[model samples]
Target: MTSHPAAEAFGATLTPGTRPTVLAVDLMRAYFDPASPLNLPDDGCLHSAARVLEAARAHDVPVVHTRVSYGPGGLDGGVFFRKVPALAQLVGDSPMGELMPEVAPRGDEVVVVKQYASAFFGTTLATTLHARGIDTVVVVGVSTSGCIRATVVDAIQHGFVPLVVEDAVGDRAPEPHWANLHDLRTKYAEVVDEPTAITYLEGTS
Candidate 1:
């Protein structure tokens, strides 16, 4: 991997904490179903996310899944709803809003419902993590340039080490995906592959 000069200068590779919680962000049907407007090209993210989830479960690491939802008229989504009309399909009892079965949350896991791109935005995620003594957040989900990036930025700001599993996240386009990963690696979080993240989870647990 080529190191960025800015990242090298700023010392951006922050150490991960011993305690980690897998923050699976928006791996829902909308992003997985090819027929859906928000769909990506393939189910690669589902497979990767499932592997990370399996590792987390076996290691007894905490897992939290986030789904985007809005109010009836999208009044709760605010300007964000207006900005992105496709998000309207996620509100209410829309089946597209549901999580993909492959990466479904177990009953024991916390499911965070959010309206904005950032999982921490207008949610109790920070407090929930604090209560559980989780110092590191392992983020995995769809759209690297969107929610995944937003969540990583928020996770670090809230005083937690953020590690983004590269393969476990995807975007509709490869350019934005790779670009965001590079940006996140240089700025907000550690960008690792699924195997590396699994090793970390097992070692810590």
Candidate 2:
């Protein structure tokens, strides 16, 4: 791989794991709507995520997806609902809060409805992964500076090695996207591209 200044300076490397679970985080319509305040222009990330999903399926790796949805009247959201008042609008019934069509969750795949950034926060994600014997996580999805970053950090804290697929994650702007990837590469997770991750997963399995 060609070296990037930040990546080189950090000297981070990902140790491939034999058992990997793929986590697709918040690749929903709210992130794609042109008028939405959170929309990221470089949404090609979803395509990369879809490719990773395909590879995961081919390898029979467990797949998990997370979306932020509040209950009716925002009862399930609590303080997080108040912090981002707009979340109240994304009630369980809101179609806009659903995963985007391009990367829709499969029938047997686990869909985690979380109100916070970290997928493991107040959710069954960690327990489910543990139950399934997952030791590594291949992460893909939107808002690299937000949910993706939170997931990476929490994955490490939860004892799972995080492998962040760079091209499969996006942010509202390039600056946050690049900065967060750099930080993740240095301190939290292994920042890699889709093909590298897919090949590693295939080889390990």
Candidate 3:
């Protein structure tokens, strides 16, 4: 099952966590709006993500969401905001920053507001999941090479298994998207498909 020489030699890879939690990150309007520079172009990931969310809800798994927000002038955004000026769209009440209806969190789901790419950074995500005894995080959302990748790496470091759904994460370009997913599958997380994710959620509750 190994895809690389080292992996085949050592058989080192990630595994799925038995107790599942659905984590939807940055499913915001900016990524879906063609006019926005953050637009992902292929919106199919949204539909796949919505399906995974629905399955999670049906099975009664814990759910959490993360969205980026910056105060006026983005002073709180720090270097990240300076590097990506386009993130300004997420500031305040901009419609582009709102969660996409397709994957928006329902009442009672934890909504984490963060300034950086990793959901666990500057947020209560790790402690919250750890407190609940959630062993694995099923992640879905935008920007495979950025936020998704960052979150996956941290999830494992924090002891929560990270399962990144390939069909449910998007990037501006295919190269970074595929490359990150590939590296993650071998190193940090188990990069699965939408069907596998749904199956995992269905088995929960």
Name the candidate that leads on lDDT: 1
**Which whole-number lDDT from 0 to 100 does residue 13 have in model 3?**
58
What C-alpha lDDT values do all the predictions have? 0.92, 0.87, 0.90
Write model 2 residue lDDT over 11-107, tens digit each, in one string. Answer: 5676857789999999888888876766779779999999998888888887899998887888888887788766665887676687888778889
The TM-score ranking, best first, is 1, 3, 2
The digit string of per-residue lDDT tens for model 3 on 119-176 reads 9999999999988889999999988999999999999899888899999999999999
Q: Give candidate 3 misplaced runs (Cα > 4 Å).
A: 1-5, 9-11
Off by over 4 Å in 2: 1-12
What would the per-residue lDDT of candidate 1 be over residues 1-205, giving only the tens digit for each residue?
A: 8667763675356899999999999999999887788999867878999999999999999999999888798989999899998998988968998998888999999999999999999999999999989999999998899999999999999999999999899999999999999888888899998889999999987
| True lDDT of residue 148, candidate 3 | 97
Candidate order by decreasing lDDT: 1, 3, 2
What TM-score does prediction 3 earn? 0.94
Q: Estimate each model's TM-score.
A: 0.95, 0.90, 0.94
Backbone clashes, each candidate: 0, 0, 0
Model 2 scores worst on lDDT over the 10 consecutive residues at: 7-16
The total number of steric clashes, by the backbone 3 Å criterion, in model 1 comes to: 0
lDDT of 1: 0.92
Q: Could you tell me the C-alpha RMSD of candidate 2 in Å? A: 4.4
The RMSD of every model to the true structure, in order and in angstroms, is: 3.2, 4.4, 2.9
